[model samples]
Target chain A: MIGWKQIPPGMVILEAGSALKIKTGSWRAAYKPRWIEENCIQCLLCWLYCPDNAVKVEDGKRQDFDYEYCKGCGLCALECPGKKGNKAIVMEEEVR
Target chain B: MVTPLNLKELSKKELRFTAGHRLCAGCAAPTVVKMILLAACDYPVVVASSTGCLEVSSCISTYTAWKVPWIHSAFENAAATLSGVESMYKALKKQGKIDKEIKFIAICGDGGTYDIGLQSLSGAMERWHDMLYVCYNNEAYMNTGIQRSGATPTYADTTTCPAGSVIPGKPQPRKDLTKIMAAHGIPYVAQAAPSHWPDLMKKVRKALEIPGPKFMNIFTPCNRGWRTRTDDAILLSRLAVDTCFWPLYEVEKGVVRVTYKPKEKKPIEEFLKLQGRFRHLFEPGREQLISELQRMIDENWERLLKEEEIFASKEEEKEEVVK
Candidate 1:
């Protein structure tokens, strides 16, 4: 730990976006959302609603989850308005 | 009408509010933050957040969830914090010290916004600061363990005002914060929900472009405080809008505009039943409470529509006079 005098000006961490290094995906103790690519209509609601920004999207189309930071809130699966019984994203138990 | 919002193109913008930090699972605050940042993506941004969940969780010591410049403010002075920053920016720009355009935002949960920071907010708005004040209204003080706040809806059970056999939940109606901000007669005041991203983005964009104080009361559901499933924040937000419990509307220059009108307005039960905070309201003999809450919502909705009809034509008249 740095001394008070050694701390950056206003204690502001000079490095921007430093939180990306913290692997918050460990917070997901149980369920992890599985993105079934074929079922995705690419509405981007999952992308929009992910609290962690874990849903990886490119060019408006659905891609995969950045599990390193996902936190496995299962929000993507819960809000996916896919065809009945064949939702785009579904929660699976983390086999730890 | 404002230009069409292209979601596909917008999806490609750099994520200003990045991953990691300690916000609770299914926390709607991050989604709200992301939406606001995305809307203001075209410019460099500086955010001042009051001492609340977003501040406590997202920016802990050396780690920060924000990619852009960020400042943490006191519980009752986020508006003041941003106000000072904006004034400095203006001064520096005039002296040619800063060359780029930067957007300013003050964020707070309902705890700070509807109660603690209200005075500062009013003062800043009255002073016409070139900043946007966004309140992510989860309806209670969730970070402090779901205590009842001024924004907590009528009779919704909270830790401070827990429902029991003797007395049911919170005694007072939820404060109409958006309406109060509108009464300030600022350039823009809006009540949006994170569920409707397009409407929210549009409002944020419009608010930033207008060179005066703007306020947005965004309905962000708390999965923990509301005793909901971890994933229900977005849907609960949607239900809040559909039931008129939290209307999606904006008051631009004192003229009200309801953003999205549900083809069939859902009943308050649909919204209340989804959350455990309102579980007591549905119990036997508590039917009166439900009806009373419904009546309150209906009255507010009617008043908003009436205001829209009255002032909408007047807005057109102002435009005509300008032409």
Candidate 2:
């Protein structure tokens, strides 16, 4: 999600903790996690293991990931409980 | 009063350290970082890393793996740098220039903590900096070609102390850096491993809550340096704890508590055999080294138990006096 457009060269970040402004979704190069809400048990293991905190959940239920920040680390997919059979969240190759 | 019922609510509230770093696939440092950051998520944190693998790998030139405010300066002075940062933050907050509660975390490896950065760390802790210092001790100088360090275990092969006919490996026992830090009489000192997430997480929360300098010597296994498969890092860490190679314990106000004790303490060979660094010890005529290693582990474990008992009885006596 962190693209060249959002970041300027010369390492000039004027404000402290300003990284929140930079959408790092563009950092995912090859793959992204595709969530199947129906199959999700809402265990939230994916949320805990997600390095990017990309797995979005609301009201104690699972939601679609915020691609605006996910770096395609595949940790969520790796930890997704549905991997045994349900396949709630799968890493699909990026079309880009 | 509110409590997180499950992992989902917990993540929503505090996900400080986001993933996607260049740390090796199975290395324990990233996990350790994640757990520690999550534990300290209640406060805004400024994390600083010494010139080590975690720094170089995570902060690659322009691209940074850190989601929060982070700084990387030199190999030996992360504590000093963060001390300055904490001092400045305190000053700014007092002057009304800054208004948020910020916690400081200094991260380093064994090379930095047990050797190069000892003076800086001691000075910072002695001066009573309101910071948490974490040493991801992988035993050797893992960032610099796996050279032996002050924290290296005896009879382990390293670049500087390679196993050969002349010498088996490193000649000396590791310095008890945790006890040394405890000697400073800071609020908290602990030894933890990534394999025990709940224990490590608890310690992190406790450390950050304490009002002064706190230190955690975490066993971060290095797949590359230990010459083990990348996926075996966590397994090795668990073995390290079970075999008493890295005891799980904490010291608070001079009170020693052994956090985890294996039901059947696995022999040190169970741990050493997993790594190629100790492969030479299993060779012909070198079986003696294995027993020696076991003897050392047994002695240390016994000493730790005695210390804990002495402190526990002392506390009981104090309570009796109060009654």
Task: For all candidates, state DockQ relative to the true structure.
Answer: 0.79, 0.19
- Give the local distance difference test score of model 1: 0.89
The models' CA-based lDDT, in order, is 0.89, 0.82
Q: List model 2 lDDT by residue over A1-96, tens digit each.
A: 456677666553434423444466777778888998778888876665454556777766778998877767565665566845887988789988
lDDT of 2 by residue, B22-92 (tens): 56544667767877887776777899999888887776535566767887778889999999999999899
Question: Model 2, stretches more than 4 Å misplaced?
Answer: A1-96, B1-6
How high is the TM-score of chain A in each model? 0.88, 0.76
- The most accurate candidate by TM-score is 1
Candidate 1 docking classification: medium
CAPRI quality level assigned to candidate 2 from its DockQ score = incorrect
In model 1, which residue pairs have backbone atoms overlapping below 3 Å? none
Tens-digit per-residue lDDT, A21-74, candidate 1: 888999998999998888878778888889999988887777899999999888
